[model samples]
Target: MERISRKAAEARVLDLDGREHPLRSLWASRAAVLLFVRHFGCREQAVRLYREKGTIRALGAELVIIGNTVPCFARAFREDLAITTPIYVDPSMASYRLLDIRRLREALLSGGALKHKLSALCGGFRRVQTRLDRSQLGGVLVVRQDGAVVYRHLSEGADDHPAIEEILAALAPRTSDEAQASL
Candidate 1:
């Protein structure tokens, strides 16, 4: 993923209710982890986010999930995952486009994809057909309160994700200590 400067990162994004808001508002007051999901139905990303929620929150960063899914699907997905993360809709995928995200076919024919598929299935995350665009890729952006993107991760494949430690470290210096403590 390319680094997004504060000047280039300003854009409008919609919420789950079709309300418009400046995307910068997410991280304007505090750090934020902007998780642009492939779709709410993608189990691997959901589960990963689900598992890491507390760690992310503890770092004093807001976790927001944006996607091309409709409002209804967004609600159901959040409920299913039992997460309170702020979810948003991007029907036109304006943010995705502006962020330069692109589809990766390798995600389909790779060992990582196979692992995630099986993991998702066994983990009880069934893929749902909601007429959403599955081909559209997703990514992550860690924005500082000043709107600078400190961390950005564009998916390389279906199961690609950034290292948790890297994300935590960027939010603050304590994550390194927290990680070592856990180990």
Candidate 2:
């Protein structure tokens, strides 16, 4: 799994529509919010999650979801939830691996060092942490037209995360001129 450094060059990711959507293009053209959903097995869940959170209009950034689930399932789920954000299907787990997101809760559960009895007792705890972390998967990367990561929120665990408002603020142009200039 590759860690995306704050200084790394911007890369393009495919939309759920499978278009070669470039991050630079979005920065140059408009502000974008890349949402990484790990173990996104159902699109309905994705849609409900986003919709319930009001992610689309609240963030005012392009919604880009990356996950290791079937696109068809995601699509159906999104449709059921009435997600307006453009969804992207990362069937290959390329984005997940690139972002270094854990794909399975069980992977983290049994792999940790612990006594046999302790492991079993901690399994439930690990599962909860994994779910929480998965909910916060994908670092929210705010970039500029020149491909600079102006702001980044990389999580060390599941609970610590950047708020939607903070992400919107990061996506906001630094100056009025800068904001207008992009348009």
Candidate 3:
């Protein structure tokens, strides 16, 4: 896998409604949170994860799901929860590959390949496949307007991620007077 610099780019994204939107064109855009959900339909879990943690309001950032798993997520959240965040569908996996989150190759060569294939045949591949997609596990990345990744917590283990409060604290900006007072 090619190394992806731990930097955020000013890239264009499409919303669920197929409308083109840019990162720079958001309201009170203090920061942007990009959640890379694995599989083709895991939108529900992503929404639940965000809502349960109060991620949207706490972080005060635009929440974006950058993956092709919208079908799964949409079905899960649409039927139960109200998702306020925008979902971007990258069916080609371009974003996932660019982010170095594709684990299919590695999983195909690993000892768990057989199990994963069997699971796929039984319509349970996502559960098994997700265990192999290490890069997309979960992470909190703070990106400044200058396209710099100020902070990041990339974890390989499941459920090992930063809290919404922690992310908010990291992204909080100090006023010029506050900076001067501190000095």
Candidate 4:
């Protein structure tokens, strides 16, 4: 339940259409579940987020996927996954760096990484990627309209992700005093 700093909240990101937006814009008017993926080719993360989109919306939160690649890859991913949820990219990775997201190159050979790939195959998702940053891990954040970050999860490795239930729980309404303190 750590709060996002002002600097991180103001970091810039680009939409699939290549328009820039401040990081807070995604949640400025509603609760947002920001999913930072390792890369657009990571179908396992894509499918997992896509599957949780409904439940997340049911809890009055919007799901946004942020990738660390060019807009074209994000666009193709949206089409491939048939994702209605909005997608954005951070080519400069300023948001990632400000949030202290990890970059672990050695994790590529970890057991969890292998498990994720196998899971993606079992789920009928496959993609061949090249020349993308594989070491940059991603995480999840639940932010409120007023800039209160109710939940934050920094990935330990490329295969790590937060539980959907934990994300949903973070969206539960907070008291005025609690919300005020976070700001």
Instruction: Say which candidate scores most in TM-score.
Output: 4
TM-scores, one per candidate: 0.82, 0.54, 0.54, 0.88
Sort order, TM-score high to low:
4, 1, 2, 3
Candidate 2 per-residue lDDT, tens place, 57-92, comes to 454455555544555655654665566666655555
lDDT of each: 0.76, 0.48, 0.48, 0.84
Candidate 4 per-residue lDDT, tens place, 21-45, comes to 9998999777899999888887676
Off by over 4 Å in 3: 1-12, 20-28, 40-45, 52-60, 70-80, 102-138, 155-160, 174-183
Candidate scoring better on TM-score of 3 and 4: 4
- Per-residue lDDT over 29-129 for candidate 1, one digit per residue giving the tens place of the 0 to 100 score: 77899888888778567567657878888888888888787788888887777778888877777778877777765436478878887887897878876
The TM-score measured for candidate 4 stands at 0.88
RMSD per candidate (Å) reads: 4.8, 8.5, 7.4, 2.7
> What order do candidates take by lDDT, descending?
4, 1, 2, 3
Clashing pairs in 1: none
| Residue 148 of model 2, lDDT score | 53
- Candidate 1, position 53, lDDT: 78
| Candidate 3 lDDT trough over 10 residues, lowest sum | 1-10
Residues 39-63 of candidate 3: C-alpha lDDT, one tens digit per residue: 4233333544466345454655566
- Candidate 4 residues lying further than 4 Å off, grouped into runs, are 174-183
> Residue 96 in candidate 3 has what lDDT?
50
For each predicted model, how many residue pairs clash, with residues at least 3 apart or on different chains?
0, 5, 7, 0
